[model samples]
Target: MAPVPKSMSGILIDAPGGADVLQWKTDLPVPQLQDGEILVRNEFIGINYIDTYFRTGLYKAPFPLVTGKEAGGVVVASSSPEFKEGDRVGYISDHAYAELTALPAAKAVLLPAGITTEQAAASLLQGLTALTFVREAAGIKQELGVSEGPWTLVHAAAGGTGSQLVQILSVMGAKIIGTAGSPEKCELARKNGAQWVIDSRSEDVAARVKEITSGRGVDVIFDGVGKATFDLDLEIIARKGTLIVFGNASGPVDPVNLLRLSPKNIKLMRPVLLSYIVTKEEWRSYATELFDLIAAEKIKIAVFKTYPLSEVRQAHEDLEGRKSTGKLLLKV
Candidate 1:
């Protein structure tokens, strides 16, 4: 292998605030490969709302932390038997924001043929998250009593993760009702397989959902937006319905009492994707299923936009502003 660069460019968050806090430094040292680790030359880095949480301190990170975790790249150097030089791969990690970074071999997954670097970057974290939401968290089996399919409410349905959820649930025969803030975003959700898209700007969500479900509410509500939608979700959930609160894009939800769910005997869950993907076996199963859906064109992983590494601040600006739908990537 060629010699590693003395330094590489990356975005760092020195203190939590707005997009301005993203500190871009060109002379960041190239991470060193360690035993059981592989060095990668990143091609695409995905920008997720979780990155925003870390950036704005909704989720804490050590000071001066790198700003992203999702990226697709090719192995340039390897010290692990499981990975070799020249292997195309993608990874999710706290250290993936750089041009070159070291990752544990166990955390890396080889990019299957026909899956491009951009696609892998965009889908691995978000797609697998959506899959686990429908298959595991939503309890689409006996637990939720909707083995074939259920009426699902996906908030922010045109978003990177939400869009993936809509697509996957669409394939699984679910009746999906998606909520978006704008007409365009609503249309995007509809395009990705949502049967009904509600424009939050113009419609009362509870009323619309009740109208659509004829007051029975949906079988499941996948709510990524927290405080802003929590009450509305509870109101629109069906008897014994499941409500999966996955992300806090708008803001953290307020404290809740277990008694709050007694009205309908609703099932409330807070699932973390990181927990589900921690084991290599679980990661592989979800990732394989995600790629298979993509390969068969059953799911479309949307790359809404891309920015050069230098423009990472603008990327963050757009993401935090909710200006882009689907996946946003930084071309590294």
Candidate 2:
């Protein structure tokens, strides 16, 4: 191994506001490890909508905090008995937008053999989110007591997390109807295995869903767009359908009405990934399944763009402008 530095470059959000708050600095220290922790040399970082929230103060974080929540890298130092130096790994953390990171063993997962660092970075946070939504929240099983061709509606179909959900549900033999804002993104959704794609900006989401399902509504809806799409999701859900509200890309939903779901027999939930993986065994199992899907060519991670660490301000601008499709990565 070559000599490693004591510090490296990273992107930081110094205040809540806009793109101006994203600052580039090279003095970020190579994080020190405590017991059961590892020092990693990151190669790639994931850029998602929540990262924008952290940047804009929609989600609170300490000022001057690192801006990424997901990354993949090689472990350079460790005090954990299970991890060794040079082990490839990936994880989601509070602040990971650096060339180096210190992660607790509990928050990290060893990258499966044959999976590239890029794939791991693209998969972990988004893949785990998809798994938690379908398997845990939606209760998607071989038998959910629906018709042979059950439908699942996913908002922001071309996004990192939504793409993963399409892949997962398609593999489970469910018909997936996805909403994207553009024709290009609609094509991307179809290419990623969505059975139907609705241009949410140009089409009536509820009507398109009804047409796709032949006058019946969908079996489940994976809603992350919150205020913009959550109400429409409720309108299109079939009786006893499950509506999983996992994020708020459009903005926070105000005053949820549990009473509205009564007539539809709907199951509404706010699912979180942390709740789904309560133990090391559960994390390993989900990671293993995700890797198996990749290894078997059942899923593909779409890396839409990559920016150098210093250009994260431009990256956030592009993301907020809705110019990005699929996962955006920051290369260290």
Candidate 3:
């Protein structure tokens, strides 16, 4: 094993702003592990939209934060009995833009033999988000009275979390309608298991979805586009359906009028991934199912690009600009 270094390099932001605020430095001190923590030398860092939320001040954090939520790496030091030196793991934790991250043991899972470090980094956060939301948020389960699946709509279907949602919904036998910006992305969404695709930019999304469902509207909608599509979601959701809004790519949704939900008795939810897996048991159960799907080739990971740590600014720009598809990673 390589000896632990006294210092590390990573992107640091002193204040919330735009991509310009992300600064790369080589002299940051290595993080000291607290009890129930493990120190990992990160090989690949997952770049998520939530990272952008923190960078742009939409999601508040203390100044000088090393903003990152997930990474795949090998554990180099452990203060917990559950992990040992050289264990390959993927974890969800803060301060992950760095080459070294001190992770809480409970938020991590040991990488199975068939899963690569890069794959783990790419899929863990988004995959688990899709899995938990479909199971818990939408309640689309065979045992929970959705035996024949539901008519589901996933916005941004070619994007990271969107792709995963499409794939999982397909596995659960849902008839999926996906929306994307372009023809190529629409094709990608189809390949990821969207049975029907809509060109959100040039098409009438509500009309297309209504026609596809034979004027009945979809049973559930997974919308990450926020304000840009929130009203439209209400237009096409079935009575007693669920609307799970999980991101703000086109900006936050304005304050909603609760009276709007009264007509259809629509179930509205705005969920964060962390809230679903607060306990170790919750984390482990979902993570194990996610890895099983990966190993079985039921869920395919699509990495749009892996940027060098220094090019993180460009990466963030591409992500926020909606220029990339699938998962984005940083090579640490």
Candidate 4:
């Protein structure tokens, strides 16, 4: 193995703001390993909406932050007994917008033989999110209870996490209704297994959803569009249904009335991916299942574009502008 470098190039943010805040620097120091941590030479870094939240101070962090949460790379140094110098890994951790990251072994999983580092980077965060949401958040299988699949709705269904949710829900036999901004994205959502696709931009979303479900409303609503769609979710969710609001693509949903949920006996959840996989055991279990699904081709990864580290500003612009579908990645 080659020796690790003393310095590397990465994106840094001095303070909260917009995409302009992401600064590329070539002299950033390679992270020094700590106990229970391993140093990774990142090959690809996953771009997520949460990164924007951190950058804009919506999700507060200290200034001069290295704001990224996930990446896939080869372990170059280890202070953890569970990892070695050449193992391939995908991890969720702070300070990932860099050529190298020192991440806790607890937040990472070993890559199986057939999966490439690129695929690991692409799927780990979003794939596990979809799996956990379906299996636990909505309790899809348990709710089936010997009946036909339940009616489920996914907002922004052609986006990274949304695509994963649609595919997993399809495999679990759920009848999926997906909403995307444009016809192309809506078609992509249908290709990912949405039984019906609504153009949220041009169509009456709530009406289409209600019409498609025969006015029963959907049994499960997976909304990542936050403030823009929360009211619509309330209007269309079925009696005793579950509403899982997981992202803030349109901005955070305002505080709930609680009374809103009472009328329909709705179950409301605002879950974060980190909370679902807190322990090593939990992380590995879901990650294993996620990788298995990918291996079986039950879930397909769609990478919209790969930006060079210096082009991260434009990547953020494109992502925030909603100009791209599927996942955006930064090549490290």
Note the Cα lDDT for every prediction shown: 0.88, 0.84, 0.93, 0.92
In model 3, which range of ten residues has the least summed lDDT? 140-149
Candidate 3 on 115-190: residue-level lDDT in tens? 8889989999999999999999998764422225889999999999999999999888888999999999999999
* Lowest lDDT block of 10, candidate 4: 139-148
Q: TM-score of predicted model 3? A: 0.98
Extract clashing residue pairs from model 2: none
Residue by residue across 101-120, what tens digits does model 2's lDDT show? 88888778888778988898
Model 1: residues with Cα > 4 Å off, grouped in runs:
141-148
Instruction: Rate residue 217 of model 2 by lDDT.
Output: 94
TM-score of each: 0.96, 0.95, 0.98, 0.97
Name the runs in model 4 displaced over 4 angstroms: 142-147
| Model 3 regions more than 4 Å off | 142-147
**Local lDDT at 72 for model 2:** 91
Using lDDT as the measure, the top candidate is 3
Global fold similarity of model 1 (TM-score): 0.96
- On TM-score, the stronger of 2 and 3 is 3
Clashing pairs in 1: none
Q: Residues 1-332, candidate 4, lDDT per residue (tens digit)?
A: 99999999999999899899999999998888888999999999999999999999999899899988888999999999999999999988899999989988888899999888888888888888899999989987634522259999999999999999999998888989999999999999999999899999999998998799899999999999999999999999999999999999999999999988999999999888888899889999999988998899988999999999789999999999999889999998
| lDDT score for residue 286 of model 1 | 77
lDDT, candidate 3, at 127: 95
